[model samples]
Target chain A: MTAKISIRGVTKDFSVRDHDEPFTALHDIHLDVRTGEFLTLVGPSGCGKSTLLDLLAGLTAPTHGEILLDGVPIEGPGLDRGIVFQQYALFPWRTALANVEFGLEAKDTKKRERRERARHFLDLVGLSGFAERYPHELSGGMRQRVAIARSLAFDPDVLLMDEPFAALDAQTRETLQEELLRIWEKTQKTVVFITHGIDEAVYLGQRVAVMTSRPGRIKHVLDVEFEAREGDLRADARFGDYRHVVWTLLRDEVAAARQEAPVG
Target chain B: MHLLKGLRRVAAITLLAVVWEVLPRTGVVDRTFLPPLSEVLTALANLAATGELLDHTQASLGRSLAGFGLAIALAIPLGLLIGWYRPLADFLNPLLELFRNTATLALLPVFVLLLGLGETSKIAIILYAAAWPILLNTIAGVRGVDPLLIKSARSLGLPAHRLFQKVILPASVPTIFTGIRLAGAYSMLVLVAAEMVGAKAGLGYLINYAQFNFRVHDMYAGIITISVLGLLFNVLLASLERRFSTWRATS
Candidate 1:
């Protein structure tokens, strides 16, 4: 299968104070995201999973190497990619429908057409009754649903989610994960989802890319071959084995990161 | 229940008015120094019938609204630009601070010199005084926007202008409206001071004119009208703030 996103040896560096050494956020990262696949980047905090997603989204320039969308070199943010954030960043003043219509408006779609498109997405996300309500009026789960609807309204080729369900409670998170899978199945768009949750990665992703901490680099990429449905997967024998293998790879990286920290 | 609450409010106001009327009539205070409530109301009615009170009230309202509107127009865009762009903010920061620190009322003489002793000078002073709260509040509002929201907008492929319209502007609105309401009150206060130093119109002019003519009843009426007008403007802006901020719980 052809890759929708190709990251070739991408490296990102951040400058500290003046004259101080630059901090490397990502080191020699090379990854391929297959078209119409759900790929999850999983690791501990500071593992540069978010940085990698940013690079893929064309929000930041890599200090080294390159990222290409389809065959074209990724330059800056464009209409082909949509992003959902952990904080559910819906426009506060806009009703749920209008917030979803924002991308269509940016593309200068006609008013009636934008409204129809936005309403369709809102209905898809189970928010049809709440189209007129503002973001602040919605509950946390409802807000995230609205965020998802807003992103999906663009009908982008790829959806980049940076821990989109991380801020939610466990029940809400699981429900959203299920909702996301249903949406992904229906939309058939490639998704690059970043998360710290190993279970979430196992449950939702076709492939899980595990990274080592500090100056983060990919340690392993495991293709999940478990039952596709949500129920009893955690109790399945194969699921435990995959979790243990990913956990073992992650344990050493977490230890190494802790050892390298400067003591006060 | 709502009717009961309304009746309670009326009863309290009537009680105060009765005390005010009875105290002066019973010689509890010098009648010349303190007019009875009846006399004050009679004077207010006479001024209203002659349309003199409405003229002064309308004049004050016009000046305050114009000054406040100009301040809002100038402050919001400048503040948003300053907040969004670091270099622009750095350049404007010290200048804005200096202007904010400078006594706005002290510039009354300068306005008088430049615009002359006319409505223009009075309105200019009101603008100068009202501009600071609005400008500073707008700056604060824009600066206070959550960075996460901006990141989300950018990552979602929103261009600069669209990001501002979709994310930054809506997020900063509540704080900006707060600034506007504060500026609304400041406009009236500054306009009154400016009017006192100048022409032949407005509540301040009427008060000064009444003092010279020794129409103590008209002076009292002017003072009461100023208070009522100030309260009405405050209520108007406060209601607007409430209406706009229904989506924003924190504000």
Candidate 2:
């Protein structure tokens, strides 16, 4: 089957301050995201998983090579793709419903239709009654939920998420993960999720791509199969095996990445 | 509940009035400079009866408002552009700082020299005074907007104009209101000073004329009128700020 997003041999280099050598974030990265697949890119800090995700989102062009969505070269940000940033970057001026309807308005949908769709997605995210609440008025989890509804409301073919739930508490993360899974299943939108958590990678993704340290490249790919996994599916032995395998693949890279760069 | 406070204020004012009336008779102070409050009130009533006070009030109000209106029209848009556009800001920053640092009233002589001792000079001075606060505040407001909001709007495929309308404009509104509100006070100040420099009418001129002629009570009346006008302006702008501002508890 043809891939939904074709990532060619992409290399990203950033010029740092003064006369220092350019930082090689990602070098010669090749990945083929299958249609309607839930692909997770997992690695430690400085692995360029987020950088690669940015390239896919068309936020920045690859210094070398190119990214293609549905056989067409990715030019820049578009409605055909949706992104949920890690920071829960919801516009504070807009209410939850208006925030969700933002992209719909950008798409030039009529007023009544945009409101209807926004209401539907807010309900899907369990924030139906929070339509009038502003971003500052909502809790952290609710803000992220509004953001997710915002992304999904426009009906993008592929969803690019960069550690969307990394900022949430453990309990909220788990609940949102299950909710995300339900949304993914219901919508059947191709998802390219980036995270450092091996457990999270194993639990949510159909396949997890492990990456090397700085100047990251795909180190390994593991096809995960736990059919129709419920929210409490982590108790299974097979799920534990997948988690262990992912951890083992990432352990050395995490250590090497830590040694190379001290995190904040 | 609030009536007691109002009554207290009235009582304090009455006490001052009684002291002014009795103090002159008691020979505690010279009555020429310290004219009785009743005399000032009677002078004010006489001015009103002859419609001279109305004319002076209208003249002062017109000059102040014209300057204020011009400042509002010019400063806000210029501030928005300079704040939003780095290139424009870079070009204007040095010149703007130079103008902003110079005292507004000190240039009244320069304004009179160029525009003559007409309303133009007074209005020019008022505009000069009003511009700085509104413009600076607007720049600060727009510049301080969360960069993430712009990024979010861009990612949503909001075009440049739409982004300005939906995000930048609303986000900077509270700050802009702060600048404009402060400008009301600035307008009063500059207008009075400019009028004092050279004018036949306006509250400032009335005070100046009365002082030179030794009509001390009429001078007091002029001072009181200027204060009242300034207070009214502040109240107006404060209410407008409250109505237009979208400040929220969320941020």
Candidate 3:
């Protein structure tokens, strides 16, 4: 299968004040994101999972190597790749409808058409009644829903999400995860999601790539089983088993990451 | 409870008016120097009947609005440009800092000398005094736009100009309004001073004219008129701010 995104020999570095050597974020990373698949990257805190997502979003460039989209090198941010940040980053000045219509406006869509598409995406995210509400007026989960709708309304080839539900409570997280799966099934859009939650990684990913600590590298890629259905996947024994499997691989990495320069 | 609070404010204002009328009439202070409120009201009516107050008020209002509008037109675009393009800001910061630090009213003599004792110099002084607040606040407003908003917009392939229009401009509105309000108040403050320097009409000239003629009541009328006009301008600006800033916490 042709990969929608190709990452090869990617290394990221950060320059610190008064330090001669730069901090390494990702060390010689290699991965292929196959088309139309949900790939979750799971790792310890400071394992650079968010950094990797930022790279895919083209917010920052890797110090070495390159990322490819459709055989074309990704130089910087483009419309073909959409991103949902962890912070919900919705413009406070814009209403939920205007926020959803953001990408459409960038594409220079007609006002009437933009409104229609925005409404459609809001309905997809189950937030149809909140078209006029501002970001501050909405609940945390609803705001994230608007953020997701915004990413999808643009109709990008790939969606890169950076721990989008990390701020939500347990009930909201589970609901959003299920909603995400349904959206994935309906849209069949290629997704690359980053998370530190073991069960979240296990349940959501078709394939979960576990990473080692600082100067992150993929240690293992586990194929997950089970159909994404309506009921809670946490109840399934296989889901529990996958969670255990990922936790075992990730525990040492977590400890090592927590000890690694304290992620200043 | 709200009604009680409103009543308190009304009672306070009424009490102040009573003191103003009674205090001077009682000779606590000279009646001519600090005329009774009734005499001042009578003088205000006389000035209005003779169209002196109207002409002076119209002149002052026109100068302030003209100068304030000029400042807004020049400052907003320049501030956004400086804020967005770092190299341009780098080039301009030293110069801007030097000028911004200098007292704006002190430049009045130079403006009057160069532009002459006309509306030009008065407007010029008001613009100078008014520009700094708008310029500085606009720079802050543009710079303070949430970085994530810009990043997200860029990732969606928004070009620079569209990014400014969509994200930067709307985000800057509240702060820009803050600057505009400051400029509005500053325009009145500086325009009055500028008018005092040399002007045939306006509240400042009227007050000076009254002082020379020993018409203390007329001077008070001019003072009261200017205060009312300043308050009116502020109310108008505050309403505009409220109207545009419905989506966010302005305070």
lDDT of 1 at B212: 86
TM-score of chain A of 2: 0.96
Q: Write the per-residue lDDT of candidate 2 for residues B91-179, one digit (tens) a residue.
A: 99999989999888778889999999888888988988998999999999889988877777777667889989888998888889889
Model 1: per-residue Cα lDDT over B1-251, one tens digit each: 99999999999989988998999999998878678988988999999999999999999889988898888888888788888888988998899989889988888899999999988888788888888888888888888888877886787667788888878888888888999899999998888788888778889888889888888888888888888888898999999998887878741
DockQ for candidate 3, please give it.
0.61
* 10 residues in a row with least lDDT, candidate 1 chain B: B242-251
User: Chain B TM-score of all predictions, in order?
Assistant: 0.89, 0.90, 0.95
List candidate 1 stretches off by more than 4 Å.
Answer: A227-230, A259-264, B1-29
Worst 10 residues of 2 chain A by lDDT: A255-264
- The Cα error of candidate 2 at residue B169, in Å, is 1.9
- Model 1, A190-235: lDDT tens per residue? 9999998888888888899999988889889999987556676778
The lDDT leader among the candidates is 3
What is the alpha-carbon lDDT for the whole of candidate 3?
A: 0.91
Question: What is the per-residue lDDT of model 2 for residues A1-264, given as tens digits with 9 covering 90 to 100?
Answer: 689999899999988878488888999988899999999989888788888977887778899998989999998888988889888878776789999998998899999999999999999999999999888888788999999999999999999899999999999999999999999999999999999888889888999999998889988889999866874689888999999998988899888986875521
Clashing residue pairs, backbone N/CA/C < 3 A, model 1: none
TM-score of chain A, every prediction, order shown: 0.96, 0.96, 0.97
Candidate with the greatest DockQ versus the true structure: 3
What overall lDDT goes with each candidate model?
Answer: 0.87, 0.89, 0.91
Taking the tens digit of each residue's C-alpha lDDT, what string does model 3 give over A1-264?
Answer: 799999999999999889999999899899998999999999888888888888887878999999999988888888888899889989998889999999988888899999999999999999999999999899999999999999999899899999999999999999999999999989989999999888889888999999999889988999998875447678988988999999999988888876766774
